[model samples]
Structures are given as structure tokens and as C-alpha cells.
Target: MTNNVVIPSRCWCGKGILTYVSKTEENPYRRFFRCEIGLKKKKEQHLFKWVDEALLDEIQRMHE
Candidate 1:
């Protein structure tokens, strides 16, 4: 069974590429990524967090 996974993607800010930082167990160990550029800007710059599934549900509902 594969344990570690690498997600190749860019940040929302279009600043720098993001990499998997850590994993959480809120819902079966979800992977989290963060923007390197945004991290250097501020501690709470809103770039170092995982995309929550709840947000996706809300977005899908909005389009329907």
C-alpha cells in the first residue's frame, strides 16, 4: 500500500509552487500543501492550508 504521495501543483497566489507539507486525520488523513512565497510574507497569510472538502461542497451547491 502506498503511504506517501506527491502532488505537483502551483499556489493560488501564482507566486510559487506548493508541495505536500503534512497530513491530518480530520477525515482519514488528508494531505495539506502550502505556498513557499506566501509563507515568507506572513505567518497568517492564508496560503499554508489544505483545501477543505466543505468549501467544495459549498461551491458545488452554488453552481446548482
Candidate 2:
């Protein structure tokens, strides 16, 4: 069984609003997030990626 986790709509930089960009097909299956307001500033652009289920589960099992 699998579940779709809803990524929160908050930026890591404490910005209130964030936007979804795209998902990567890499081993960790990155789901990208971009800060809406931070993008305006060339240096302050904030983007992050959340790993998908498979990689997360693997890591969890390793620690067990």
C-alpha cells in the first residue's frame, strides 16, 4: 500500500507562501518546493526537495 503525503505550503525560510515546482525521477524521488516571494530576489531564492516514500522507508528501516 502507498499514500500520497501532502507537503506543507510553507517555506523553510519562514515565508508564508510556497509553490510546488516539479518531481524528479531520481533514486530519492525529489519533490521540489519553491518560495513564492523569495524568487524575486536573485540571491535569496529558496527551494527545497522532499524525498519520496521508497527512500524514506529504506532509511527508516536502516535505523530500526
Candidate 3:
């Protein structure tokens, strides 16, 4: 999905994006972006992206 990666500022539901650190053992302290509303609701699909991956994608795009 490299071609589709983009930094998201807003969710499809119009809510603001929020950055949060992962608490899971698999990715402790890893930062990610998610839709604020979806994070609370937990029943619908929403925007979720890894900050590092997004930045990498952006950098790759710049080089390209």
C-alpha cells in the first residue's frame, strides 16, 4: 500500500486525527495516528496510520 500512504489530518467521519503511543507488547511506545471518534466508538472503520511509516512514505515520495 505504499502508493496509497498519505499523512491524514482528518478522518472520513470529519473528526480530527489523534496521535497516540501503542501500549501493546508487540509495539510498545510506537506512535500512530487514528481517528478520534473511531477510537472512542470502536464499532466502525476509521483512519489509522503509523507515524514512522507515513513519514517514510512521504520521504520516498519526495525522492521519487
Give all candidates' CA lDDT scores.
0.52, 0.53, 0.89
Off by over 4 Å in 3: 1-5
TM-score of each: 0.35, 0.35, 0.89
Can you tell me which runs of candidate 1 are displaced by over 4 Å? Answer: 1-14, 21-28, 40-44, 52-63
Model 1 earns a TM-score of 0.35
- RMSD vs true structure, all candidates: 10.0, 7.9, 1.5
Model 2 agreement with the true structure over 1-64: per-residue lDDT tens digits = 2342334466667776554445444534344445666667758756443435435755666676
Residue 61 CA displacement from its true place in model 2, Å? 9.3
> In model 2, which regions exceed 4 Å deviation?
1-9, 22-31, 45-47, 50-64
Per-residue alpha-carbon lDDT of candidate 1 for residues 1-64, written as tens digits (9 for 90 to 100): 2222223255556666564545445535654456777667775463454546434544665676
TM-score, structure 2 vs. true: 0.35
Candidate 3 versus the native: TM-score? 0.89
| Models sorted by TM-score, best on top | 3, 1, 2
The lDDT leader among the candidates is 3
Q: Write the per-residue lDDT of candidate 3 for residues 20-64, one digit (tens) a residue.
A: 999999999999999998888888999999999999988888888
